[model samples]
Structures are given as structure tokens and as C-alpha cells.
Target chain A: QQPVQSPQAVILREGEDAVINCSSSKALYSVHWYRQKHGEAPVFLMILLKGGEQKGHEKISASFNEKKQQSSLYLTASQLSYSGTYFCGTEGRGGADGLTFGKGTHLIIQP
Target chain B: NAGVTQTPKFRILKIGQSMTLQCTQDMNHNYMYWYRQDPGMGLKLIYYSVGAGITDKGEVPNGYNVSRSTTEDFPLRLELAAPSQTSVYFCASSGGLAGRNEQYFGPGTRLTVT
Candidate 1:
């Protein structure tokens, strides 16, 4: 099943912080985060595996909570380049080849 | 290396027509996938292959067929295309190992069926 993302659209000013949450009905083995601009392929941000591991990239970080079956992406001091749609892909036990992506969260950062 | 490449970035097909969307990867990844994205909607997997000669259906595989005859190529065939099949298709590959499964996607093909 596909994951569910909260806050369908979010508009933020530069230097603001925003949190995007993704929840899955089935237990997730790993949660993948990607960002896509208009007319472009999604770019990988980071993958959060089981055991509640948190990974960070620059001012962005994500945490995977297997017990809660959810993940959250945190963006701090957002930049203009961060303006894009963010999607969270989830993989369950039997999923190895492809991922089930959520209906992305549209984030727009204004300068 | 060109991570993952898809051919015919865009195409328009008439009803009942057929076409194939080609996907290739140079990274020698063992896992390849095909997905479709409707306007303002999340991507839904159409088909996937773990390796050459092993293909399986995904969430939405009714109007689509796939073949994996080589490690670098996985093509998706749409037979008797319908207007419902109008969407952007993406081909992706991932390195499947102990725990790494980050997928690299192609530019995507915007297909319109009239």
C-alpha cells in the first residue's frame, strides 16, 4: 500500500523551518526521501532504515520510527533551492525491486 | 556513467495503438523498475525486475507488459493503449545488496493517448 503524507502543500519564507511527515499502514523496512522539481526526475535525499536511525544532509535530516511506522523529514533554515515537491518512498518486507511512493508534499520556499 | 536512461522522452499514441518504452542503465544494477505518474499524483509501480529473465507485476500492471532480457535493459510495452494510460512514465534502477536500495530515475517519458 502507498504511504500517506501530511500537509499537501506548504509555503514557507526563507530561513523558516518545516516538517513533512509520512506514515505507512504496513511496517516499513526503509523509508526513502526524494525531491523533484518541475519537469525533472526525483533526486534522492536520504534513506532511513529500521532501528530508528536518523540521517542528515546539510540542513535537512530525516528520522525513521519503525515502531510508529512513520518517518519525518525536517528542513531547517530552508533555502530557495528547496522549493519543490518532496516524496517519501516506502519499502516493506516483500518489496525489493520497487518502492511505494506517497502523494508528495509540495513545498515552496519564497525568498 | 549514465545512471539510468529512457528513450523517446515523449510520445502521443492513438487509441488501440501500441508502443514500447525503453529503459537502460550503465551502472550494472540488478534491480530495475517502471512507474507511472498521473498529473498531481504519486507514482505507481507498473512492473519490476530483479535480474535478467525475472520480471514481476507491480501495483498497476494491467495494461502494461515488461521484459528483462539483459542486465541493462528493461522495456515496458503498452498494448492497445487507452486514454487512461496518458501519464508520465519513469524508469529506475537500484543497487540491491545488504541494505542499499536507493533508486536512480530517468528523465521520464510523457505519453499521451488520444
Candidate 2:
């Protein structure tokens, strides 16, 4: 089940804020967030396991809603270095099934 | 220690050619995975292994094959490549622990089949 992400792309200025949302049709056991800079490998940001759980990485944070099968990533006071593509991967009702990711949200932070 | 490493940063192949994408991780993770990313698209799982000698197909495993002979190494093979197989391939590994879902990723291999 490919997760659905909102705001496929967004642009923000330095010290700005943004949110990227991901939802899935099926139930999600866990949600993983990662960021990929241009020409670089994707770096893990954080993971939300239980419903209503939240995790953070520096100025970024994420929340998972088990009932809605949705996850949201919040970027606070964005910086130019924050410019990258953000991906939300969901491990849905898993046994042996691997993580399925959304299309991704391209974030651009301008100075 | 190198988290995860993939060889052949980039490659161009002719149709019907065969090649292997090498992946090795030093973290001694229990789970390893292979994925491909298309232009402006999310990464799609190609194959995954929970342990050595145990591999399973992913969502898109049509033209690719994988083998895990050791804990630290997972290799993906392309047999008779097709133009549709051209994509950026990534290798990843993770511990089975709940909090360790954050998989370590390697710089992907960009493969183009003509």
C-alpha cells in the first residue's frame, strides 16, 4: 500500500515552518521519516511506532495517528540547509512485507 | 564503520546484459533490503532478507534477483536487463529492534539499461 503524501512540494524561507503529511489506506504499524539532499543518500530522521506517539530530530518532529493511519512531519524554524526531499515510509500491518513509501515532499528553504 | 556501502556508483548496460549490485554493511544488522527509485518517485522495495540465506520478493522484483550469503552482505543481480529496469538502486540495512526501523542507507547505484 503506497502511502499518500500531501503538498507534494513546498517552499519556505529561513526561520519558516512547514508540514508534510502522509496517509495510508490500510492500517499502519509504524511510520518512518527520511530526508535526502541533492546527490546524497537518504538520511533517517525519526520513527513513530505507537499511535499518538511523537518523535523529534533537532528542529524536526513527527506524529503518527493510528486510527487515521496517518503521519505528519513538522519542520520548525527551517534553515537553508533544510532544503531537501522528505519521504514518509509506512510499514503497514507487517509480517514480512517491507516498508512502502509515499511519493515524497520536495522542500526548499530559501534564504 | 561504514554503515552501508554500494558499489558501481553508476553504470550503463546494454539490453540482455547481466550485472550484480554489491551491498555490504558493517553494522551487523539482521535485516537487509534492496530498493529502486525512479525519477521523482518514491523508493520501491525490490527484495529483502531477514537473515543470511533468507530472501523474499518485494513489490517490484520482476527483473531483479537477490542473494544473502552473509550477515553483512546482500547482493542484487540483474539477469537480462531491460530498459524498464533502469533506475537508481539503493541498499539498506536495519536491526530488528522496534526502535531501529531507521534503516541505514548507502549511496545508491544509478543503472541505465539501453
Candidate 3:
């Protein structure tokens, strides 16, 4: 099943912070985060495995809570380049080769 | 290395027509996947392949088919095209390992069905 994302859209100014959350009903083995600019392919941001792990990429980071089957992406001191749609893909314990993705969270940053 | 590449960057198909979207990867990854993204929506998996000659259906697989004859190629086929099938198609490849499953995506094929 596809995961659910919170705050369908958000707007922030430069130097602001934002959080996007993703939750799945099934037990997940790993969570992957991606960012897509307008008219471009989605770019991998980071992946958080089970065991309540957290991963970071520059000013962006994410946390996965296996117990709750939830993951959150954090963008600190947002930059104009951070403006894009963010998606979280989850791999369940069911041994599926593909990850189920959330609808996506649109983040817009202004100068 | 051209991590992932897709052919036919843009196409327009008539109803009931058929077309194939080609995808290739130079990463030698064992896992490849096809996904469709509607405007303003997230990626939806259509099909996936574990390796050569191994394939499986994913969410929203109807109206589409796929083949993985070689480790480097996975092509998606759309038979009897419908307007609903018009979307941006993306091909991705992954290492297929526990912690190394980060997918590398192709530019994408934009298709429109009339």
C-alpha cells in the first residue's frame, strides 16, 4: 500500500525550516527520501533503515521510527534550491522488490 | 557512467495505439523498476524486475507490460493506450541489497494519449 504524507504543500522563506512526515500501515524495513525539481527526475536524498536510524545530507536530514512505521524529513535553513516536491518511499518487510511511495509534499522556498 | 537512460523523451499516442518505452542502465544493478507520475502526484510503481528473465507487477500495473531480457535493459510496453496511461514514466535501478537499495532514476519519458 502507498504511504501517507502530511502537509501536502508548504511555503517557506530562506533560512527557514520545514518538516515533512510519511507514515505507512505496514511494517517497513527501510525508508527512502527523494527530491524532484520541476521538470526533472527525482534525486535521492537519503535512506533511513529500521532500528530508529537517522541520516543527513548537508542541511537536509531524516528520521525513521520503525516502531511507528513513520519517517520524517527535515530541512534546516532552507535554500532556494530546496524548492521542489519531496517523496518518501517505503520498503515493507513483505520482501517486495519495489518501494511504495507517498503522494508527496511540495515545498517552496522564496528568496 | 550513464547511470540510467530512457528513450523517447516525449511521445503522443492515439487511443488504442501501442508503444514501447526503452530503458537502459550501465550500473549493472540487479533490480530495475518502472513508475508513472501524474502531474502533481508521486511516483506509482508499474512493474519491476529482479534480474534478467525475472519480472513482477507492481501497484497500478494494468494496461502495461514489461520485459527484462538483459541485465541492462528493461522496457515497458503500453498496449491499447488510454488517456489514463498518459504520464511521465521513470525507470530506476537499484543494487537490490538490504542497505544498498538506493534507486537511480532516468530522465523520464513524457507520454500523452489522445
Candidate 4:
């Protein structure tokens, strides 16, 4: 099943901070975060594995709570370049068939 | 390395028409996936392949088909196109480690069915 994302949209000023959350009903083995600019392909942001292993996108950070089957992306001191749609894809413990992505959270940053 | 590439960046199809969206990856990844994103919506998986000659359906697989004849190519086929099938399609590839590897995505193909 597809994961659920909170705060469908958010607007922030430069230097502001924002948090996007993703949760799943089933146990998740890993969570992947991606950012997509308008009319562009989705770019990999980070991946948080079940045992707290995280990788990719040094500028962006995220946390995964294995017990809760949830993950959160943190954007601190947001930059104008951060404006885009964010998606979180989840892999269930059953297997890594493919990621089930969330509807997406739109983040807009103004100068 | 031209991580992932897609052909026919934009296309328009008439109802009941057929077309194929081509996807290729130079990364030589073992896993490839196809996803469709409707306007103002997130991506829905259409099909995926673990390797050459292996494929499977995903969340929204109707009206679509796929083939993975080689490790580098995976193409999505739309048969009897309908208006509802119009969407931006993306092809992604990941390394051998399923959940541990980050997926690289292609630029995407925009299709409109009239």
C-alpha cells in the first residue's frame, strides 16, 4: 500500500525550517526520500534503512523510526532551491518488491 | 554516466492507439521500475523488473505492459490508450541491493491521450 504524507503543502521563507512526515500501516524495512523540481525527474535525497542506516544527499537529513513505521525529512535553514515536491517511498518488510510512494508534500520557499 | 534515460519526451495519442515508452540505464542496475504521475498526484507504480526476462505488475498495472529483454532496457507499452492513461511516466533503476540503494530516475515521458 502507498504511504501517507502529512501537510500536503507548506510555504516557508528563506532560513526557515520544515518537516515532512511519512507513515505506513505495515512494517517498513526502509524509507527513501526524493525531491522533484518542476518538469524534472525526481532526485534521490536520502534512504533510511530499518537498522538506522542512512545514506545519500549530504545536505538533507532524515530520521526513521522503525517501531512506528514512520520517517521524517528535515529541512533546516531552507534555501530557495529547496522548493519542490517531496515524496517518501517505503519498502515493506515482506520484501523489496519496489517502493510504495506517498502522494507527496509540496514545499515552497520564498526569498 | 547517463544514469537513466527515456525516449519520446512528449507524445500525444488518440483513443485506442498504442505506443511504447523506452527506458534505458547505463548504470547496469539489476532493478528497474516504471511509475506514472498524474497531474497534482504522486507516482503510481505500473510495472517493475528485477533483471532480464523478469517482470511484475505493480499498484496500477491495467492498460499497460512491459518487457525487460536486456539488463539495460525496459520499455513500457500502452495498449488501447484511454484518456485516463495520460500521465507523466518515469523510469528508475537501482543497484543490486533493493532497499539499500538509492534509485536513479529518468527525465520522464509526458503522454496525453485525446
Query: Count of backbone clashes for each model?
Result: 0, 0, 0, 0
lDDT of 3 by residue, B1-114 (tens): 989999999999999999999999999999999999998788988998889999988888999999999999999999999999989999999887423467889999999999
Candidate 2 vs candidate 4: the lDDT winner is 4
Once fitted onto the true fold, the runs of candidate 2 whose alpha carbons sit more than 4 angstroms away are A52-58, A92-96, B97-100
TM-score of 4: 0.97
Give residue B82's lDDT in candidate 4 (0 to 100): 99
Candidate 1 DockQ vs. native = 0.59
Question: Higher-DockQ candidate among 2 and 3?
Answer: 3
Worst 10 residues of 4 chain A by lDDT: A91-100
Question: What Cα-based lDDT does every candidate model obtain?
Answer: 0.89, 0.87, 0.88, 0.91
lDDT of 4 by residue, A4-99 (tens): 999899999999999999999988888999999999999989999888789987888899999998999999999999999999998633444667
Tens-digit lDDT string for candidate 3 (A1-111): 889999899999999999999998988888889999988999989888876565546656788888898888989999999999999988743545677788899999999
Specify the CAPRI tier of model 1: medium
Query: What TM-score, to 2 decimals, does candidate 2 have?
Result: 0.95
Can you write out model 1's per-residue Cα lDDT over B25-53, one digit (the tens) per residue? 99999999999999889889888888999
Q: Model 1 segments beyond 4 Å from truth?
A: A53-59, B97-99
Candidate 4: regions farther than 4 A off:
A92-94
Model 4 C-alpha lDDT per residue in residues B1-114, reported as the tens digit of each score: 889999999999999999999999998899999999998888888888889999998889999999999999999999999999989999999885547788889999999999
